[model samples]
Target: MKHGRNLPKLGRKAAHRDAMLSNMAASLILHHRIVTTKQKARALAPFVDRLIQTAKNGKKSLSARRLVARQLYSPEAVEKLFSDTAPKMSDREGGYVRIYRLGRRVGDGAETAVVTIGMATIKVDKKEKKEAKKHKGERPAGYDRTKDEEIFLEKAAAKSKTAEESAEEAKAS
Candidate 1:
């Protein structure tokens, strides 16, 4: 019996290796970048790239992230997050990562690649924020009350029901 299977079963054990890669991939997604062995980067690049591409489609639901986290089970995945990935791609509509081939690894002979995801910008309505500031003391959306108008409403609400209206309503009820 072996006492320490403590480390991740990275290679040779295939499924476990895949799981480890997936975990690393998820983290890379959230963090936007990570440094690792060239072999690992190579394997992880495709997985994480695809994951970000999935998020690019705007299916960035809690369920999707949770499912990704389940496949990835890595602390990195949750922390690194796809928040940027989804929003960035929300504009472009496709193709997230661009892989650049770097030279060989220092330790091992594995080939290195720098995988970058496209963080395109979508111009959101800054005017909405401006409008919000302008209307700060004014009514909320769909509320057409001016400050004076709102005060009038508040006073109207504060007023005791008129006896005739109350009596009529009471009679109707």
Candidate 2:
């Protein structure tokens, strides 16, 4: 008998769910992308999209800002949404947020996902990528086994010498 129930409860009551969604929406608006659970990402996608739609429809009007402000947790997020995100999305229609499934969590085994603004581009530095590929399967830089062993031996010898000196002092006394 699950009929006409559009919104997911997300394991929280009405007020708590709204607060969590508001915080999550604010974070998503401030930072272009966020990593979260798959279910949360799914819930966040539509929530953020509606805010973007509101901003887009209102065209940065005072009422629109106030309306969006009511749903978002941060005023800065509201400003960014109205000034930056909304304008960028003006050319397009809905679907402002995009969710990408990122495997499962290691600890709790919950499914993970990456929620990102649809227009944002995630960039990886070419030099860093090249270095990573170049050093794949190789020891990290400045890792010298001989040097490490020497340092360990030196420390152990120092400890032994201290112990011997303390023993000699005890015997002399």
Candidate 3:
């Protein structure tokens, strides 16, 4: 009985499949759209959708970012997913990704598809847009960057020092 065991193997080992999916998901997050074999695109759509769903959970708390980071394997991609991509779909309940068939590949004639974030076509509601704006970490309108830079630099230095200390402790242990 092959019940409930439906993740496509994609002709690769578990680690290889996971790694490929992680990379593809990161690329999708960074680029917003990607082209690949239909099989791979189908496999990737749900994977990316789940990540987007997780990203829709309010503002990017440290814990939420860390959870998505574990699956994305790219810090920048995870950051974009939470800060940018996720907010666009915050109002939508599910189906965060869309796949379009693009005829076939040139070499092996494999079926190809374009996977994209679903928010590109839909008009966002005003209320949702306002809510999304609050989570984006944008400065207040007409804010003065010159005055803020000092505070920003101080916070950045402190964060880096803590990170370095943690790394050093791990090494010593």
Candidate 4:
């Protein structure tokens, strides 16, 4: 009898668990990342993946939106799921989410984890690293170090020249 009932109860009744999972899934959809207990994160990852899969399948279909809406219950989250999140994951088959364990909590000692959409990290080349070191301050807003190194350096040099000119003008004044 207990053979197939292997899902974690999470110390909650069926309705409570469903509601919690729905809310958590909606939050994850809207925010793209969340922090929670390890067990909960594990439980949520599959749920979110399924939702993303549904969104990917449906795309702009009404039935798919309705199906996802039933589980998420948030119109904004549903829109984000269908419009933004799903399209980004269109090429991927599965495993849309990732979980990172964060060791134990300080107060209760419960293990924590970060659940997030699988975002790709940009690799920094040796030349870029050397260029980044040459300019030793925070990059300007909208400047992507990985993609626009030369543009960033050009802007930095322009800014430095402007700053020096302003200083010289001030001294002359």
Q: What's the TM-score of every candidate structure?
A: 0.48, 0.69, 0.66, 0.68
TM-score ranking, best first: 2, 4, 3, 1
**lDDT per residue (tens digit) for residues 61-121 in model 4:** 9999999999988999999888899999988899998888889999999999988887532
**lDDT tens readout by residue for model 1, 1-173:** 86864533446486778767776666556655555656666566566656665554536477667666666776565444555456656666445655566777788777776655555222378899898788788755676548778899877876655766888899999
Per-residue lDDT of 145 in model 4: 68
How do these models rank on lDDT, best leading?
A: 2, 4, 3, 1
Query: Model 2, range 92-144, lDDT digits (tens) per residue?
Result: 88888888889999999999998999888676899999999998989877888
Indicate the residue-level lDDT of 151 in model 4.
79
Between prediction 3 and prediction 4, which has the larger lDDT? 4
Q: Write down the lDDT of every candidate, Cα atoms only.
A: 0.62, 0.90, 0.87, 0.88
What tens digits encode model 3's per-residue C-alpha lDDT throughout 6-113?
898999998999999999999988988888999999899888888887778746578777778889899999888887888888788998888889998889999998
Highest lDDT, which number?
2
lDDT score, candidate 4, position 171: 100
Q: Pairing residues by index, what is the TM-score of model 4?
A: 0.68
Backbone clashes in model 1, listed as residue pairs: 30-80, 30-81, 31-80
**On a 0 to 100 scale, what is the lDDT of residue 65 in model 3?**
78
Screening candidate 2 with a backbone cut-off below 3 angstroms (N, C-alpha, C), the clashing residue pairs are none
Q: Ten consecutive residues with minimal summed lDDT in candidate 4?
A: 115-124
Quality of model 1 by C-alpha lDDT: 0.62
